[model samples]
Target chain A: MLIIHTALHGEARALINHFSLKRQHDMNAFACFRADNIFLIESGIGKTNTASAIGWACGMLNVSSPVMLNIGMAGHTACSIGECYIANRIEDHATQHRYYPPQLVDTPLGSDCLLTLDRPTENYPEKCMVDMEASAFMQAAIRFTTIELCQSIKVISDNTLKPAGRMKDSEVESLLAPHTEAVTGLASDLGQYRAELMDNTGATFSQLTQQWHFTKYQQQQLARLLQRHQALQPDEELIDTIPAWIDSGKAFMRWLDGHLNNLPVRL
Target chain B: MFSTIYVEEAVCDHPRTRKILQHFRGRTVIECRHYGELLNLKAQNFRLQKKQPALILAEKQGKKILPAPAGYHIGARHNYYFSHMLNCIYDCRYCFLQGMYQSACSVLFVNYEDFIHHIRQQALSHHDEAVHFFSGYDGDSLALEPLSLFAETFINDLRNISNIWLELRTKSTQVRSLLALEPWPQCIVAFSFTPEDISKALEHGVPAIQQRLNAIDKLQQRGWPIGLRLDPLIDIEDFEQQYRGLLQQLFSVINIDNIHSISFGAFRMPENFYNRMTGLYPKERLFAFNMERHDGIVSYGESREQDMRNTMREMLLEYVRPSILFPCVA
Candidate 1:
């Protein structure tokens, strides 16, 4: 299940609409909602709050490696104030530490680091961006889950030089609203791909077993022949002739079959 | 599918013990006096075990965290690594664990807290340095995360320690645990990658390159730090394009500004381990590669190794900063 947490409810609501998630409930301290096996918790603001909310949610849910995504606006040090940059690395400046969250693409978005601190750093350098709660949320949420389950996504709302306080809450919500849709869409697509891959793996295994069949002793002998040949793919006719060659036990044919079978199979 | 459960007598009562044992039902329970008895076994057949690997559940007994290799740190000074489990789920023909142990059964050290305690001690000892502790060296970190909760437990402990760094190296795309946590600064959940062609051919039972990349993208979008490791680089025809294409695909969508580090290395294995691996899978094409034995290490001949390394280094220099590009060999 994909568990998304954000500071703003409107943006979360917008995401629910974009992704077609249902409004579940307002569980007192934090608002709770769900959509097609994916859940969202509006955990308010700050690292401590997000951490607490995530912990509470995890305690209430039974999942195998539940993904926690903290989606909100973040100030960028490299990009312009309005542009968006996906954080490939998240760093906790207060702790002088860093982490690599699971990225969504075969190629990562960018090779930049995002700094998470208790408070925004005033006059932050162009190389470092600032976020309020990723570290606390990571620390608390990781306790209830494994590394693959936790993640945070922040859109650029302001430059590090600019105070985040100056950006109105409405402005932050609006900035995240559209991006949330994109993020949700991407998540859905990824979920589908994961399912498809699992299905394909079964077919792959069956094909391998059928294509390569030999007894334990024969497999060992084939390995030697392949090693000597230094080739993975021998002619199919030659492969078919391997049994006959083995039966004959001629030194050269025996050696060839032995070498060919030991070679690693290339998909 | 014979049922087999090798338990460490110490953690026989842990709550998770019952749940773990449940996965291997109808199996015989073997109680070993110590981990050494199992780890030091030499005559086991890795290939035969691949048909059905047993399960080992024991309490982790000694130092859990240790210093990473010299000049191995991507950006941190105090690099430390920990292994809560030993052995892997996949049966890679080249794995060294096969040669190092007597059995091919996967070993799960149930005493996670003990490992955590040792981590605390190590972090305190290197309080002034950026100590990095790497998991998945002895096993695939996340492949069994659901069963062990290993990464989940250790990541939190490492998070509290300011001077320590944690890297969960894996090929598995089991990021459910990582996606749920807020991204940490001191931990790098790096993915070890091979070219799609190489992975599909040689890395059996591992997630595809595209899936791994998709997982990386998801984490990156959610504000996670990502590291790219192309270690033990295999030599292949059109090697330049294969690796370059891999790099291009990786750098294109990866948040380059947020990249923690990128590392690449030529394939090398201990001579003894290679000999054993060759014995197990004599038909493997990987063994047939033009490898040479040098100083007790088996690897591609020096000229080929140098060429592959130099090519990859040059290719990487184009995209990643010098600081983030850590070549495994000098």
Candidate 2:
């Protein structure tokens, strides 16, 4: 699942239209939209609202490890007005706590440092991208998933030449529209990576549990044995080879271990 | 090959840090208060970061020199180890670093003078006894030689210390720096090896067995003392034939007199480290073996461990004297 949190309606409009997301009427605490596996939350501006919305969404969705993204606008010192960048470092202005999100995927977008402030700042003193929610989004999202799955994408809307007060909603929508495909592409890549890591383990465990009455400890052993079977003989199936005489989970586990130990160590 | 470099504020202006940063001229250099702020973050995956690890330059504070592990010794009564760097370049599946560290980025403590000062202090305290100092405990000693210049600088500093012994334990074929300097009498260049099939299956990014043997042959010819470290003996189906063949190939190339010491140890891991390693690579067949836990350390039971150790000991005795063989058991 991919959860995207945007700070304004203009920032969320292009992604909502691109993914064909509909308003989720049941959610009352935050404005939410959803499609098949993608969710968008239009959180109000600032760090507190962004963190509150993320916590609510995590509780409502109940996902163990969902890929999360925060897409919005940011101000830079000298970057071009319409350029897009993914944040490699995020720092909270109030507390000065910093977070470095590891870049693992191959993407065409450039990366920059992001500074999350309590309010808007017109003076671009440092050579860093300025925002209002990336730091809190990362701090909240990593509690539910790994760092590689939590990321932030920002479209440059204001710079030193053109201050923040001059930017309008339509201009924000236009700036984010061109980078919707890139943002979705990154979320898709992370979701696929998570799926590949989770695909093979649970299916075999469910198959074996239905065939025998396993004690609590026996269930853990059964899961480990099934994992070893999948690692050593990936193409072969072990569920169909169980004999009818193995009545208890203990006896079944013993039978399974005998088979796994006999397989040749390929190295 | 790193795309990013993180520099601690303390060492950002150090001469060694500045010199090393020259090599990576155009890469992104992010400054942090300490290296642990990024490397010790929660939710960081070791397996994911290993693909594109960044380089962290920092100062080694606190205790720099300490006693080595109980069995990790050559022949000295007082043995200690220090790490000027952390995390190896190679990604061996059975390495304990994956379980011990949260991040896979390599950290190079650019303050080499501080580590040297600590080594000198420890050696002075144990002046009466033959003191041994070991490197590559947390990382490889020579794998990043060109970038760190660790071997060349340390060899020059400790050349004339008669009571101090230095051991560079590594599997890297990075021997150009060692070959350029005269061999130190008290230093031993230790090379680690497993069977070819096991190396192919487990040790990723390590040089081939023959290439490593060739590198050792060159060092031995230059009058450097060579140590054979056949550690963490992996359990395989054809254990006898595989290890016997490996020992035979090693003994054929180098002169017997140059063999400083030979050590063999069975595979073992602290129970918690084993659990974390299995969580990182659940599909790995190496962790799927039926292991027994005793005293919070997991190993292939006592009978299996003794069998492997005794067999390797017998095979090694065929090539070197018994006085030079050490069996490390923890």
Candidate 3:
């Protein structure tokens, strides 16, 4: 699942239309849009709003390998207008806490450092990009997933030549329209990794427990046995080896241990 | 292969760092002032990171040589260990590295000269004692040998220090680099192994037993003395038969009389490490076994441990003399 955080409605406008996402009115704190597997949340403008929205979303959704991406417009001192750069390094000016977003997946963007500020700045710092939500978004998102699965991508809305304060909502939407395909492609690539993690794991233990009579301890043990096999044996179906007439989960585990070697070996 | 590369800013311009960075040029390079910034971070999940770990290159700033554990010595009067690297390429479940480190990312100490300097000092200071410096305690000596150039460089240097012996303990088949060089008699290429069944089940990302044996056989054919290490002997059902089969397999292929030394130990780990490993791999049956805690060490209970050792002692005596076989006892 892709949980995206955008600061402005106009920033999320292109993605909302591109993904055919429907608005969920129940989520009133933040503007939330949902599709089949993608979730985009518009946290108002500051880092606190973004962090709170991410925490709320994460508390609501329990997923195995959720991919988090923070997309917004940032002002750069030297970059050209409408240029997109992935934030490889994020620093919080308020707390001086730094977080690194690992670029493990492919994207159509180069990387630069981003300084997350408490308010907009006319004189951009030494860093290439200046944003308000990336640091907090990354700090909160990483609490849910690894550093490799999180990213902060910014489109250069303002620079030395172009100022962000002069741009309108319509202009922001128009600027983002050109890069909608790139964002979609990035999400698709991330989806492949998320699918790999989910495919390797995500086997529920209820399937075995519902049929077989077992206590709480037996159920937990059986779940670990199955999960270890999944981590070690990714290609084979561990359940297929179970005898059909096993009466208990303890017996199920004993049988599982005996056949640990039976799982087809893959190097 | 590493998905990303984390480099320390202090060693960014070092030649070893540049060499490794050349290979991973297309990948992301995150620079930190210290290696601890990435490796010692809290809330980092080792299990999740193990799916795709990054490589961290840093400089070793402090003492490089350390004393080996009391029972860890093979046949030396003074045993020491130095780690040019912090982690291994293979993911054996029995490895203590998983339980000891918070992250799965491998840390390569790029300063090989510092390690060499300390080793020479330790050997010269204890010239009367027969010191055996062991590599691959923190990481497999040969697994990262190609990238680090540690084994080739150190072996050439240790040729002058006759008082100190070098042990390159590994389970890696990346021995082609070493094969091209002259075989030093004082350096023992120790290869560790478990039974075929246990190895296949628990040893992840390692070569097959036969392939490792082939590497050893090639090394021995060139007149390099080979050592056998069967450590952390796992206790399982029909333990006698399984262990006997493994020893028989070892003696059949290699010349037992020509072997440098053989060592074996029971499966045991520190209490904290055992608890941490169990948390990372709660479903692993290896940790779930009924373990006993004596002082700070956790292992199979006394009676079961003795029984396994008795079987090992009897089987090992059949091929080699008792002096050559070192069973690490607590």
Candidate 4:
């Protein structure tokens, strides 16, 4: 799953059109657009709204882990307009707190530092891309997923030669339009990693629980045992081989333990 | 060949850090207030990072030297160990670093002067007794020697210290720096070995057994005392024949009188580390074996461990004296 967070609709317009996302009328707190395995949230402006929207989306989707990307326009000190970059470092200007997002996967766009402030500022003091919600988005997104799954990409909208007040809504859409492929390309690449992680850790409890009723604690134990069994003996199938004499969950647990322990340890 | 380099703001301008940055001039250089900001984050996938690890340069702020782990000494009254670097260049399936650290990126502590000062201070305090200092506890000492210059700098400085002994433990053949200098008599270039088949199965990115043996032969001919470290003796089919072949190959290259110390131990890991490693690589055959846990340490049960140790000990006794043989029980 991929979740895209943007501060304004103008920034999310190109992605929504590219992914053919439909607006979720029931989502009242924030404007959300959804497609298969992909979600986009227009989390108004500022830090609080961005954070609240991310928490709400993760809860609403009920996903354990999802690839999150915060894409929007940011003011840079000296970068050219329409230039896109993935943020490697993000800092909150008010509190001086910082976050470093690991750049492990391969991406086409280059990377740079990002500074998140409370309000839009025309005076750029640091040589970084200035935004209003990146730090908050990153902090909140990591709470629900791994750091590697959370990333922020910035498209330069204004620089020293180009002031922030001069950019119109159409210009904002144009700035983000050319970079939609880059955003979706990165999301697709990260999806492969998420899939690999899930492949090894998928639950195999449903197959065993069909016949035997188990307590919550016993269910957890069964999951771990099945995981170990699958890891050690990937080629062997044990679910259908249960003996008829093992009638109860307690008895089944004991029998499974004995069977696993009896398996030969071939080096 | 790192694609990205993370530099701590404290050491961004350090001479050593600058020299390293010069080597990767075109790479993406990111600055941070601290190295842990990137390397110590939670939920990092060591397997993924191992695919393409970044370089982190930082200073060693806390205690530069520490007492070696219990039973990790080689016949010395005082044993100390320090890691000038964290994480190894090699990715062995049984490496504890996968569980010990959250990230697989190699962290090079560029501040060598402070570590040297503390090492010298500790050794001088025990001037009358033999003080053994071990490198490669948290990483392979010489794997990054060409870039780190760690062994080169320390060897040149401590060569004259008579009572101090330094051991460089590694499975790497990057010994050119050591070869250029006249051998340091008190320093032991300890080479770790597993059987060729076992190494091919578990140890990734490690030099082949014959290549490492050739490097050891060169160092031995240069008058450098060699140490044989067969720690973490893996269990496999026909274990006796495989281990006997490895030992015979090693002794063929080593001179008996020049052998500084011979040590061997069965595969063992702390319980937490074992659990974490199994979680990381669930399908790994090495972790699939039904092992036993005793006193918070996981191993091949008491009887299997004892049997493997006894077999290796009997074979090692053929070439080296019993006085210099050490059994790492930890």
Candidate 5:
């Protein structure tokens, strides 16, 4: 699954309309949309809210290896308004100022540190840039997916010294419109990368399971056991199932042991 | 819970060591020459070691006890805490030790006598005042009591000191030693608890909530002073209801008169520690909270934190007196 979280409603609205038919659910704060091969989430403002929304979205969708993109507007310290930069690091300015290190997006748009503050960086300093929700969204989303799938793209809506609140809703939309095509193209590329990666990993697991050399009946039994393991909710039910699976496996191994012993003398 | 004994050569041949080493069979003995060299070494991953951590038995050289963290004490004039051991047996996913330590190995400073002597000196310094000495700050107090004999030795040593108050904070249900001892008025056997659902989800290797409560009831009946710590309160969907239910269930069975203190704190961690922990378990659902880093502390955002604290405080106040309540700010 692919998710795109945005800070402002207008920016998300443009992408949502552009990818309208691909949209899955509009749960007010976060809108879930599909863009060709990717699933997207337009997460609302601020680090804390965005983190919670992303977690909820992951849980609701049950997407294990999702490609998460925080597509939003940010105030840049060095750049002018209306310019776009793909972030290499997402820094939580309020907390220990730790940075989420760079990942797969090797774009010349350059690396900008996104400061996710509890409140908007109203008194934006020359050295510090401000964003509403990228850090928290990235932190939470990264847990559900691998490092390669986690990406953030921010368009500069204001200069460092200026407040992010001053940027009009329409102005934010206009700044992001031109990059809408670029963002969609990037999303499609990411989805293909993720699909290929999944297929490769799945193929490896399949090969390993096949090399174990179980009969058809044994394979069916193993599949049934794994399904039961996944389906059970209560701790006791799951714990109880483990022993049965283990006992069955052991019993099969014992039978195989006798059969192998009887035929091995020919060697 | 452990079957092997890892010893530093400096204290391996000590007189008291022979008795402790004889207990475990199929023991693999590895010798290290120094404690300081191994204990503080970097590149040893704390998270991975937790899976099957070894126990390190070493002697503590100096400064056995230290002052507690700021805003950590409650209802005491001089607050101090000492760890006879480092690293917990239970692997709670949210524990800071996983991020703080270079290794997950449990370092048990076998010099229990030295720790007691220092604690005694601190208590005597404040003769008339109620001096509180907390144990299990770095690790659970009674989790490995069977092997370490920590609670047994400390209980005996503390009996001589009249003014000193000891708080043995633990999440372990291994209260065999505690139940056997005649209860001391100055000693508070505290149990840290959370909602059952949360415990099951995150508190791996810890005894169930029901089991802990049963142990508490047994200890209380034996006349031991009990304390309840609901620290690092997790943010769940129906958090208020969950906490309320926990408080009600505890109060229903526990004797309120014997309750020493009830404390609660919102989930918070140092930024670096949180970062390390996140790196260790990149796919953990618990780290995916709506958290904010404010003034070097990472926690749930302000409004949500305040709401949780106020609501939990109100619920706790309903059953316990205000004087017995403590809010852990650190």
Candidate 6:
């Protein structure tokens, strides 16, 4: 699942139209749109708003292995206008602390350092893109998932030649319009791969617990063993090898250990 | 090829960094104050990142030399290990790096001068003894040789140090750099190997065994001293035939006297590393072997280890002298 957090309505429009998303419940505090497993939320235009939108999405969303992406405009000192770049390094100007979001894909769009500023300004001291919400979004998002699963892409809306204040929504929409297919394709690929990894195990612990009583540690150990078996022998069915009725959880674990012991230790 | 590059701000303008940057111009490059901020972050899926690993160019800080682990040596009393790079290009399923490190990105510490300085100091400190220095401990010494040119550059710096021995342990067939230069007298290019079938199954992305043997033969013909490492011996169904065949194949390639040393050990790993590796590659037959934890370490059963060792030792004795044999108990 891909949950895109955008700052402006135009940023959401390009992707919404590209993915054919529908408006879901106008009564919500934040604007939410959905298409299949992908969702987009417009978070006003500040750090606080970005965090709020992420929290609301997490609480209200349903699914597994959510791959979050934040796309919007950013100001750079040297990069050409309309150039889209992934944010590999994100820094908060006030805190001076930095965050590195993992870049797993190799896309047509290049990447650069991003600086999240408190207020908009023309002085782009360093060769980095200046934004307002990426750092906060990253800070709050990491609490939910890993650094790699959360990615950020920014379009160079303003450079030294073009001031950010002069930028318009239609310009942002047009800039993002051409790349919607590529962006959605990237999200789908990454999300599906991550989801498969999360679901590698054959049987869930909850399902096994219904038939047998197990300690917390036992559950963990059994889960790992089953996961290993599932990964190694994906075509085999775990239930096929089991007795019609498992008398006890401990006995079942013992039987599994003995069964695993007889297999070839090395190739 | 790397999809992204994270360069340390301090070394952003360094010549080595510049060279790498120019070579990887099409890559997405990002600058950071330090490498650890990107390389050492927790919860990174090593298995996933390894699919398209990035390259991190950083300036190594602080101590550049450290004493080698107790059992890691080849006849020298004064032994040390230094890493110019971390992680590796080849993804051998039995590798400990997957568990030892949380991230799979290859970090090349471009400050080779510091490592050279430390090596010179260690040599000067032990002037009477042969201070043996080891490379490729954390990563392959030659796998990235085309870009790194580490051996070519590092050997030049070690020209003045006469009382030290350098060991470049690797499984790569990248001996082109060494073949082009005059072999350093005390330097030994050690190659690690397993049986063809076993290696083909577990050692993914590595060069074929015959290719490595050919490299050893070429280097030996160049009058460079060679070393054979049959370490981390994995158990297979046909052990007697496999070990004997491997030993025969090795001896068929090079003169036994030209071989500097030989070392071997059973597959073993630290407890934490074993747990992590199993988690990463839960389906791997290497980890699924009959292993037990003793004194906070996981290893093949003692009897199984000793059986394999004695069998290989007997076969090895048919070719090499006993003095050059070092069975690593650790």
TM-score of each: 0.56, 0.96, 0.82, 0.95, 0.56, 0.93
For the candidates in turn, chain A alone yields TM-scores of 0.63, 0.91, 0.89, 0.94, 0.68, 0.88
Q: In each prediction, how many residue pairs overlap at the backbone (N, C-alpha, C within less than 3 A)?
A: 103, 0, 0, 0, 5, 0
Q: lDDT, candidate 1, residue B84?
A: 75
Give the better candidate number (1 or 3) by DockQ. Answer: 3
lDDT tens per residue, model 4, B1-330: 687899999999999999988889878999888878777887677877777788899998999999998988899989999999899989998888988888888899999999889988998999778899999989999988888899999998887877889999999999999999999888999989998888998899999988998998888888889998998899886789989999888877778888899889998999998888877776677886668888999999889999998998888888778988998887
Write one digit per residue (lDDT tens) for candidate 6, span A19-88.
8889989637898899877889999898999999998887777555488898998999988888888888
Task: Assess each model's interface with DockQ, reporting 2 decimals per model.
Answer: 0.07, 0.65, 0.18, 0.51, 0.01, 0.47
lDDT pick, better of 3 and 4: 4
CAPRI quality of model 3: incorrect
Model 5 residue pairs with clashes = A2-A39, A4-A41, A22-A34, A94-B293, A95-B293
Candidate 1, residue A119: the lDDT equals 68
Q: Which ten residues in a row have the lowest lDDT in candidate 2 chain A?
A: A192-201
TM-score of predicted chain B, candidate 1: 0.92
The docking quality of candidate 1, as DockQ, is 0.07
Q: What does candidate 6's lDDT look like per residue over B263-296, in tens digits?
A: 9988888999999988777766676655789988
Residue B254's lDDT within candidate 4 is 76
Candidate with the greatest lDDT versus the true structure: 2
- Ranking of predictions according to lDDT: 2, 4, 6, 3, 5, 1
DockQ category of candidate 4: medium
lDDT of each: 0.68, 0.88, 0.82, 0.87, 0.72, 0.84
lDDT of 2 by residue, B197-269 (tens): 8999999999999999999999999989998899989988899999998888888897889989988999999
User: How well does candidate 3 match the true structure in TM-score terms?
Assistant: 0.82
Q: Candidate 5 lDDT, tens digit per residue, B1-330?
A: 553356777778875566667776655444544454444555334554454466778898879999998888768878999999888999998898887876677788888899988998898999778899999899999998887788888988887788899999999998999888888888999999988888888899999988899999999999999999999898887788788889888888898998998888888999999988865664455764435889888988778777888898899889878898888777
* Reference-based lDDT, residue A136, model 5: 85
- Pitting candidate 2 against candidate 5, the one with the higher DockQ is 2
